[model samples]
Target: MAAFLAIIRRDLRLALRQGSDSLMVVMFFVLTVVLFPFGVGPETGVLERIAAGVLWVTALLASMLSLDRLFQADYEDGSLDLITLSPVPLSLLVMGKVAAHWLTTGLPLLLAAPVLAVLLHLNQDGFLILIVAMLLGTPTLSLIGAVGAALVLGARRGGVLLSLLVLPLYIPVLVFGVSAVDAAVMGFEVRAQLLVLSAMLLSALALCPWAAASALRQAVE
Candidate 1:
């Protein structure tokens, strides 16, 4: 347990020292969402109609921005080798790093989401679902991204590779996240969409760590 916490702490400390990734991701999400108002005009109705999709897509892209570094820094500095040698289970260690990634990247995006949603004149009816959907979805993004990040550890143009590998996987989350908000906006029940999002999150939680850890082992070998 201590080692698990220690890995999370170590990754968090490193993320803090190298702060640009998180800052950049948040800024990208804000700027991308902000651009929609100008491009589509400031009509509240139009903005509200599109807000769910805009936020979900931008958040998806922004989340991808920092994933390449999740394992790259450790791998480059030989810390990854040390981690693999540790007595702690590699999957647990990978989960710790994934948690740290979500803390630095996904969590910030989740927090900034409501502010951007308001900027788009999002429907008040959807706000709760939007927040709840993102809270459930963003961590799943980090978890799946960890696999992509680990898979491309030594590959050329890894950022691009990571995106290619992961973006397709992200589609379901994007679909249901937007659906939940859109459903709420339309006065429809969002329970079904939220349930699907929860199921995906649970599935990711059960599988992604081990997949990422296996990829890490392959990368180090």
Candidate 2:
């Protein structure tokens, strides 16, 4: 337990020291969503209709921008080897890093969503649903992204490879997250979509850390 907390604290402190990663993610998310209105034309009805999808897609892309660095820094500096040799299970330690990633990246995106939603004129229900869905979904993204990051460790063009490996896996979260907001906007019950989002989160939480830890072991072997 102490090791898990220590790992989390270590990653969080690293993130704080190198603050640009989180700042860049938030900036990319905001800029990407802001561009949509200009490209699609400023029609309130159209913007409202597509707002949820736009936000989710942009957030997914923004999250991807930081994933390449998830393990790359530690792997390059031999820190990953020391981490693997730690008494803590590698999977639990990996989960700590994943948690820090979500806290730094996902949480800011969640906070920024409302401002973008308003710019897109999202319905009130959709606004609320947007927060709820992102809350449930983004942590799952970080979890799955950790696996991709670990898998591509030390590979050339790892960012490109990471996108290919992770984007397909991200589809389910995007689909359900957008659907939940859309359902709420349409006055339909969003319980089912949120439930599916919860299920995905639970599934990712159970599987991704172990997969990532295994991949990390392979990378350092």
Q: lDDT per model, in order?
A: 0.94, 0.96
Superposed model 2: Cα runs more than 4 Å off: none
TM-score of each: 0.98, 0.99
lDDT digits (tens) for residues 1-221 of candidate 1: 89989988998898899888899999999999999999999999899889999999999999999999999989999999999999999999999999999999899998999999889999889999999999999999999999999999999999999999999999999999999999999999999999999999999999999999999999999
- After TM-score superposition, the amount by which residue 95's alpha carbon in candidate 2 deviates from its true location, in angstroms, is 0.4
Q: Which ten residues in a row have the lowest lDDT in candidate 1?
A: 11-20
What lDDT would candidate 1 get against the real structure? 0.94
Angstrom error at residue 90, model 2: 0.4
Question: Residue 36: error of model 2 in Å?
Answer: 0.6
Candidate 2 local lDDT, residue 26: 100
